[model samples]
Target: MESGPAIFAGAAFTLFGAALLLWTGVRARQGEPVALGVAPRAAVALTTLFGACFLLLGIWCFGRL
Candidate 1:
């Protein structure tokens, strides 16, 4: 349960989330569908999930430290 791993995870997740959001935005502007039968809501949900994971990891890491 070392804080190092949690911190790394947090950073990675945050970066991933940021990238996803950015990509989604670009795709949206291009008027491309993210997935078949999937709407903008789905993308928002995915972004939220990633953000939550990052937040949880960050809290865990800070708590450990």
Candidate 2:
């Protein structure tokens, strides 16, 4: 596997997860629910999972490099 691809994928996931969390925060501050589709807890859980995956992938990529 190429370290470049892994790094890029990890970065993408991290960015997406961060964006989701930030969006949720903004919505919550405005008195809106954290999730627009699913339950707020579910959305937060997914976001947390994605963030963890991204962090692990990034660490692995760095080690490979």
lDDT of 1 by residue, 1-65 (tens): 57778678767765766667676667767877755677776875676577566656655555666
What are the per-residue Cα lDDT tens digits for candidate 2 across 1-42? 687787787677557656766776677568676657888778
Quick one: best lDDT, which candidate?
2
- Give the clash total for candidate 2: 0
Q: List where candidate 2 sits over 4 angstroms from the true fold.
A: 36-64
RMSD of candidate 2 to the true fold? 2.9
Error of 2 at 63 (Å): 5.4
lDDT of each: 0.66, 0.68
